[model samples]
Target: MSALPMLHRAVLAACLLSSIVAGCARKADLVITGGMVWTGLSSGRAQPGAVAIGRGRILAVGDSAAVAPYVGSRTRVLTAGGGLVMPGFVDGHTHFIDGGFQLASIDLRTAATPQEFIRRIAEYAQHLKPGQWITGGDWDHTLWKGAPLPRKDWIDSATPSNPVFVTRLDGHEALANSAAFRAANVSKDTPTPPGGEILRDPRTGEPQGIVKDQALGLVERAIPPPPPAERDSALARALAHAAALGVTATAHMNASWADFASYRRMERAGRMTLRVVLYLPLEQWRDIADTIRRQGQGDDWVRIGGCKGFMDGSAGSRTAYFFQPYADSAGYYGLLQHPEASMRAWIGAADSADLQVTVHAIGDRSNAMLLSIYDSVARAHGARDRRFRIEHAQHLRPEDMPAFGERGVIPSMQPYHAIDDGRWVEQRIGPERIRTTYAFRRLLDTGAKLAFGSDWTVAPLDPLLGVYAAVTRRTLDGKHPDGWVPEQKVTVAEALRAYTWG
Candidate 1:
């Protein structure tokens, strides 16, 4: 063959290669079919359907009969067997890393009483190295017959050698031992920070070793950060656990850009199974703004989703900022973490950047302040398609009921928090305010988008558990047979939407 003929043959081969590559790129690798698919589309349109996936993108979704033709010889097929195939659940508020950390720690979630709680800690303490931080035992003592708070005295002997700090399931309060207090350099004389509290012995005028709300920082600062490898291992376990529960995505509530970087690395490595949307703290607004200016905005699956601000703490801790006094504790209202002005500024910047904003507001006053801030920011931003969220919209004022929908704010709530908090909320907010607290039905009726979440590490990550609680309104102890605040109950469909579609 002549040199010119050989060159012509090479050119023809190159053209064929390009054509084959384009054809392969356009072909779908898999098709899912034969399911009662609920598309979650508006106007209640649904049918026996199929979805074709190509390169991880949905190629098409429609009648299975029509989509079956797209299945090529090489395509993998999945039949749903007439099962309900809905969009994967999305948790709008979670602490992914904290959830992972909890998974790796000693679980004391079933500790029925203070004694059992101390025993569990004592067992965990025996295995730890000297001077190591004993962390993440979310022990709830409210289930005790008298619903008493655990004092340091009982756990002192159990964990005498090891420094111990066990948080309440809600994370609003914690019990620390003498060793932990000494390790953290905290004492009875140390004044509590603003918006926090230190429980004290009335007669002795000494610290009782119970720290509430913002006071948890007194002990947390003493613990060190986990290594990168340890974090990755825990995160892997957390994602697998999430997948088993039918979760496809989640919105992390208090993640930093550093955490976002870790997520990105996981995504690139194909190790991340669930879609993640991270919310940065409001304190890092300027830093995030400068970074966003350089890198531009992110996408739906994994993005710098929003700014998270705290308005108050949990009602269980009597630290949820409210308008009125607690019946038991005279003149006591929960602490307010941020002022309206500060919250407003955070919202304004987040809105302008088109970033979603989610605020943690568990008390009536906190919820009211959040609503006011959302209203102002929405007005200033003009007509926009932003999804503003209010995390843990736990308590509500009657007058502020309509504001949630009117301002187009989403109530990103955790239903388990209601079941957990309902038992003691009345003591903190009085009976009148309790009527409107955890009003899921009322929020939906007033036109708010109620996005359900587990707030894992705070509650179990099982959406079914949450759905059961929302529909039943049953307290943790099941004290109220008919359900606690039954009027606040939501239907199965509404509860489903909060977790699955909202």
Candidate 2:
């Protein structure tokens, strides 16, 4: 057997850093074979393969015979067997730190009944100290039998001592307990903030404890934030979780300053296990611009040059800024999170500053208007690599679908949402609107770029689950055997590319 001299891992790193590595032998640090390998090429085809990796770089990738030379005495070989060997996933969207905390928090995502929902929260609260804030439930009202929006009263007795602030899986709405209300000083008379609403009881006109969109700050502000160490620890768990799933990098779609600091500190300390592209809130475009000027968008390990804006809320919350009223919600066409003019101005300013812009637009009208804003912004600034992205472009009008490709705007979407939301979306939007919802096939046909992610903390962090959801379009329930919207179902290869290359 041919063998190459073994070199230390540190020497391999030096060889990778410096072009001249004549002294260092060409040997693989890790080798994997015996599987179907996807190179993530334009062809979207998988080949029987082996891969040799060295110094955190792909030294060789081909059929077993091709990469055999790279295998050396020190090479660590892993057999994939019949499994798939593909490129590391690039999660296009995530709430990284929050996802970590949620990993250990109460899970109401699968609570099939309102009783079970309360039960989970109540049981989880039993372990917490009195007056301690209970957060990160990620409950879905749609999962319940009647799809009832949970009221604070429902869980008030259950969590009498704890201040509870549990959000819907979509993160657009939340159920805050009475304890939370008192802590936050949120009374029935408190005026609701624009772009948000505090739901109230129809009979007594009392606050019902359901907070939507911007008004969420009322209760959220009351809950004490995790300390720096805790935040850092959460980041560590999230990174470990992501790496375990073969995720090499992530794009934190709506990141906090603390999240960026965590990533920066980790990268500086060589604790960064995965890459991060931190996109700050778009409203602070000026700050993002200034930071870019000061830090030069950081290195590839942890970049920070993009801004994310919100165009609307989610469909689950009936706040997706649609063109028409939801079938279930009378006279409600949903609402935008920000005024059109304000969004346009901020987007234009950010474009002028040359920061990548991505906005959340889940409704058809929201996507349309945001597209127009992108078009106008790009036209105003002339042409460069703007790559304007529409995060959660979940619903699109037929006409606006073409605009995504024509205008070169990317639809940064979560495929898991297709399956999860598909379970109840028809009741909300009706059959007519459902045709265009999560229209991955048509969007790809239009030559639009697709960026798929888990929206972790909102959905599962596993990209494999996302791939299954996208390829099958199967709802979480067993009902959709064929698929939820089978016609819109993308191929495994296509979905894999979105999870990796995008």
> Top model by TM-score, which number?
2
lDDT of 2 at 239: 89
Candidate 1 versus the native: TM-score?
0.89
Residue 39, model 1: Cα distance from true site in angstroms: 2.0
Q: Scored by CA lDDT, what does every candidate get?
A: 0.77, 0.84
Off by over 4 Å in 1: 1-27, 42-46, 203-205, 297-301, 352-354, 480-482
Best by lDDT: 2
- Residue 353 lDDT in model 1? 74
lDDT per residue for candidate 2 within 230-331, as digits (tens), equals 888888899899999988888887888888888888887899888788889999999999988987888757888489999899888999988889998799
**Model 2 lDDT vs. the true structure?**
0.84
Tens-place lDDT digits, model 1, residues 246-283: 87788887886667777776777888888787778887
TM-score list, all predictions: 0.89, 0.91
- Candidate 2 TM-score to native: 0.91
